[model samples]
Target: MNEVMDVIRLFLPLIVVQLLLMSVALFDLYRRVSVRGQKWVWVIIIIVINLLGPIAYFIFGREKSSEY
Candidate 1:
């Protein structure tokens, strides 16, 4: 039980952060008009790729201001 608690304590913050990031990404994805590529593709990437998925969406998926 101690070992399990230790593991959970260490990973709990990460899980929380990951969920937060994913939710924000999904929300942003839903609100945007156009991203760098297909909306469905970004949704799949955000849902399936874990932490990096949302980061990737922010870094590469979103279009530049000049694009609009």
Candidate 2:
């Protein structure tokens, strides 16, 4: 029905946004965990504490050579 289609249209963008955010978080977690000197425990931190995971990565996970 037209009403169902309209609801889907409205919800699609929200679904896309959530997926994008989740992807970014996962990528950040992988990068942080792969650091050479750092322990792998941070990956657990990221998984159990979602917001803190990315924040810790940004604060502590940056390689000396890369800005991101």
Candidate 3:
């Protein structure tokens, strides 16, 4: 039980961050008009690739806005 707690303590922050990233990615995906790839493909990547998936989506999936 102590070992489980220790492990959880060590990884809990990372898990939380990953969940946050996933949520943000999914929310953005839902709201955006266009992404660099197809919506379903981005969804697959976000759901399947774990931490890197959402990071990749945030970094590369979004199309640049000319308005900015």
Clashes of each: 0, 0, 0
User: Between which residue pairs do clashes occur in model 3?
Assistant: none
| Candidate 3: regions farther than 4 A off | 66-68
Supply the TM-score for candidate 3.
0.91
Model 2 CA deviation exceeding 4 Å by range: 34-68
| Candidate 2 local Cα displacement, residue 49, angstroms | 10
Ranking by TM-score: 3, 1, 2
Best by TM-score: 3
Q: What does the lDDT come to for candidate 2? A: 0.61
lDDT of 2 by residue, 1-68 (tens): 99999999999987676555546766765655255345456555555665566556556755665533
Task: Tell me the alpha-carbon RMSD of every candidate.
Answer: 2.0, 5.2, 1.9
TM-score of 1: 0.90
Candidate 3 lDDT over 19-66, as tens digits, reads 999999999899888888799999999999999999999899998973
Q: How far off is residue 2 in model 1, in Å?
A: 1.6
Which candidate order results from sorting by lDDT in descending order? 1, 3, 2
How far residue 17's Cα lies from its native spot in candidate 3, in Å, is 0.2
lDDT of 3: 0.92
lDDT of 1 at 23: 99
